[model samples]
Structures are given as structure tokens and as C-alpha cells.
Target chain A: MKQILAVDDSMSMRMLLRASLTAAGFKVEEAEDGRAALEWLDNNSPTLVITDINMPRLDGFGLIAELRARDRFRDIPVLVLTTESSPEKKARAREAGATGWIVKPFDPEKLAAAVRRVTH
Target chain B: MLSALATEPRTRRHTIMQGESEVSSDQRMVLSTVLGSCIACCLFDPTLALGGMNHFLLPTPPEGRGEDRGEAERYGIYAMEVLVNAMLTRGASRATMRAHLYGGANLHEGMRAIGSKNAQFARDFLAADRIQLVREDTGGVLARRLELQPASGRVRCRHVAEHVPDGRPAAPPPSSGHVELF
Candidate 1:
């Protein structure tokens, strides 16, 4: 089973990601916020990570930076799912080593394509 | 400035009309808003006109409940569920209810995290709860002043800012001759 870590501040968002990924044939895990996501990463290394930008404690930028700076997680694919369409945030995310970016309210079809594109 | 104001017809009595008592054979709700950093989402059941809204600030609620049955407190999960459940209690079915969402604004600077989280939060909640989002207008560079008409399931979101998302200071276009049937 290709393990996928879905992280977001909203349980609702995580629910959608889990259902969509599970229906697509991948094992899914959930994280309520960015800090929790990093903690989850410590224990289990998933093939792909899908995260939202705004969170309670540690935001997505912090999570992505932490992941990118580490050699073990450097190769893992990270995708940002957010409502921030601003170019400033997008540029910062790209520089932080994100593999892809998808706007909010994403469909299953779009998610599948992103996963395919990022995951080897 | 006072000379010009004195010439106008001083309208003393502002029109104040109350709405219908929320009644839904199925699930319907009523809600309130608070806090500048937070965005309120009023999810209504189109069939029943019964739903509720929550003012969510950060993405997740303070930890302790641990996704157990007590998760009804998490902003993203709990708040949305509470609104949905409020409608379901009024005899509305979740499957048939069409979600009408409102409120996603950038009220503060570093608060970009909150704005993004709230927008994604609402969208994901509806998707997870198996509810269909009939209409959505979110993530602008302004705060929202909204009112939910339970009778019609119409959520009017007014961008309350001197500027729009495009960096232009403009009032929102008038709401007329437009409908999103999805």
C-alpha cells in the first residue's frame, strides 16, 4: 500500500483527502495541524504529503521547511493544498521545496493527477 | 462638509425588517459571527433551509480531545459538524442538503494562515460530510459582512474593505441577475 500523509488544520479537509485517497487505492493518514503533521512524519514516512497552508501552531511553511532541510525526507514529495492564490505565497512555497500546489476545493481527478505527477 | 450634509433629506428611521422564523422539515440552522481574525461559515440545508455557521479562527481546535467523540470542538471538524447537525436535528437529511457557505477574508496581516485555513476548512468539511457545495466565493483581500437568509438559503457575503482582491478599492458588485446552479 502506498502510504500518503494528508495534513490540514481542518478535520473536514483531512476527511475529504482521506476518502478520496482511500477510494483511489492508497492508505491515508490524517493530521489536524502542521505541528501534528511533523510529529506524524517523525514516526511514519509516507510516499507523499499533502498539506494546507494556514494552521494553528506550525503552519505549512514551517512543516515544509523542516522536511526539506532534512536529508531523509528531502526526496519525499510535498504538495500544498490551500486557498492562497497570491503570487507571493506561491513563490515562497516553491522556494521551500514543494513539489506541487493545488487550490482549495479540489476534485478527486485533480488530486490523482497531482499525485501521479509528484510520486515516482 | 456640514453645509452639504444639512441640505440632504435626513432619513431618521432606518428600515429594519426581521426575517422568517427558521423552519425546516429537515435540518436547518441560525448562526452568529464574532472576532476579526475569524470567519463564520453558515452552511444551510437548501431543502429545509436549516443550517448553522461557525466562526473559526485557526484551522484546528486546541488539542486534548484527540479526534474522539469529543471532536465536536475542533474548528474545522467540530464547528462544521455542529452546523450540519443543527440542521439534521430539525428533520433535514444530510444527503439531500445543499451547502451554502460564506465568509473568507484576510482581516489581518500575519493572519494569512487563518484565512487560508478557514477557506480550505469549509471546503474540506463539506466534502467530508458528503454535502454538496452549491455556491462559494472566498479568499479575498477583505473582511466579509454576511447575512444568511434561511428561508431562501441565500448567503450574501459583502466584502467589507476599502480594497478588493485585485488591490483595487471598490464596492462589491450588486447581487442580481446571477445564479450558481451547481
Candidate 2:
């Protein structure tokens, strides 16, 4: 089974996503921020990462930067899931090695499609 | 239904109507309140159970809103930032101060998708910076009352549905479980 990492501070968000992903046959791991995501990464490697941009300890941009710095993680597909729609942030994310962007209150169908494309 | 279900009576209870947030101490209990249409983000330091709630009307002000309308305070971004900052000033860390956001019930009544929009805004704002919403009662054509024990982070949700709009859920808190009241 393909594993997916969902990094966000909201418990509900993780639950919501997990419900959808599980139904689609994907295993999901939850993280609250970039720092936490990093910690989770140290022990496990997920096939895909869906992270939010504004987190307490380490925001998405910072997380991507950290990911890109490591050769081992450089190739992992990262999907930015957030409410921030600024062009500047979007460009920054693309530059930081993000695979794509997914807005919140996400359409599970669309999200599943995105994840499927990147993971496979 | 509210009077009946809530008839059991809370030793102390607060009713935050839609588009309002308040901080108050009554008798021996200090209560902060609000109602959804807007979201009421309740910030509490569980160790201290000390916190405040902000009822932001729009994700941003409704475009042409007046400058002095305190419009700045009625935004999810500002509300989250301010409440967290306030709690921090009182010696709370961003990590420790858990957020309990209420409202954004997609009361899609009449012409306004206000509740849905608010819900999306709340999710985006908090998700941007990984803040977990512990408890939530959103969506439906119901008006909800949120009571937070800032000291313990124990919260109660009372649904008040008399007449309203149609919409989806606007709650952003991580779902632990939920008691559905229709």
C-alpha cells in the first residue's frame, strides 16, 4: 500500500483527509507542522507528503527547504495543502520542490486524483 | 430545542450569538462567547484553561465595509493572530495554546454562502500554520452556542436551530468524534 504523510495542525483536517484517503486505499500519517513532519520523516518514509503552509514550529516553505537540502528526501513528491493563495507563496513552493498545490475543504475526489498521479 | 436540551442547565453557560465574541466572568466563572455565521476561535491554554474567543464575521471584511467598523478585528487571520498573541502575553506558548474554533456552519440560508466561506477561511488560516481545532459543531441550518472552560479546555456545544439558511460544515477543528444533533 502507498503511504501518504498529511502535515497540518488541525486534528479535524487529518481525520477528514484520512477518512477520504483510507476509502481510496491509501495509508495516511499525520503531522502538525514542518518540524513535526521532519520528526515523523526521520523514522518513516512516506511515498507522498501533503503539508500546510502556516505551521507553528516549521511552516511549509521551511519544511520544503529542509526536504530539498537532503538528497534522500529531494525526490519525494510534496503536495502543498493550504488556504494561502498568494502567487508569491505558490512560486516559492514550486521553487522549493513542491509537486503541486491543493486547497483546503478539499474535494476528496480531486485530492485523490492528485495523490494518485504523484505517487504512481 | 435549545431550551429543552440545555434545560439541564449548565452550572454556568455562555451563548455567543452569530457574529459576536466576548470575554466575561460571571459570578465566579469567566466566560468568553460567540455564535457561528462567522467562526468563534476559542484559544485556551489547557494547563491554565485561561483564554479568549474571537468571532470573526468574514474571512476578510466584506469588501466595502467601513474602515472604523472594527473590520480589522473581524477576520480569521487577524483573530487567530491576536488571540494567540494575547494568550502568549499572558505566558502561553503557541504550541500549548490549543484552539477551539466554532461556527462556519454552512447555514446556506437565503442568498449568503457566508457560513461556507467562513468555514473555508478558518480551515485555510489555521491549516496554513498547523493549529489543531479540538472540538467543533458546524454545518446544517443550526445556530450553535459554544462554552469553553478556558481552565480545562472542556467545551460544550448547544445547537439552536429555529430559522436559518442551507449550507455545509464550516468547522475546522480536528474531529475526535461528534454528537450529531438535528
Q: Which parts of model 1 are misplaced by more than 4 Å?
A: B1-182
TM-score, prediction 1: 0.46
Residues B29-82 of candidate 2 have per-residue lDDT tens digits of: 434444547677776665555666667767754444422223434555445554
- Tens digit of per-residue lDDT, candidate 1, span B1-182: 00001112322211111111123322132222322434455555555545444554445544533222222233444345445544654656657777655556666687666666777877777776677777766666665555554544545456665532211111211221111110
What DockQ results for candidate 2? Answer: 0.03
Model 2 - which docking category?
A: incorrect
Model 1, residue B130: distance off in Å is 18
What is the lDDT for B134 in model 1? 75
lDDT at A18, model 2 = 86
State, as a TM-score between 0 and 1, how close model 2 is to the true structure. 0.50
Per-residue lDDT for A20 in model 2?
A: 75
- CA deviation > 4 Å runs, candidate 2: B1-182
Q: Write the per-residue lDDT of candidate 2 for residues A17-116, one digit (tens) a residue.
A: 7877988899999987789999989989899998877766788999999998988799999998765555687788888889887644355566787888
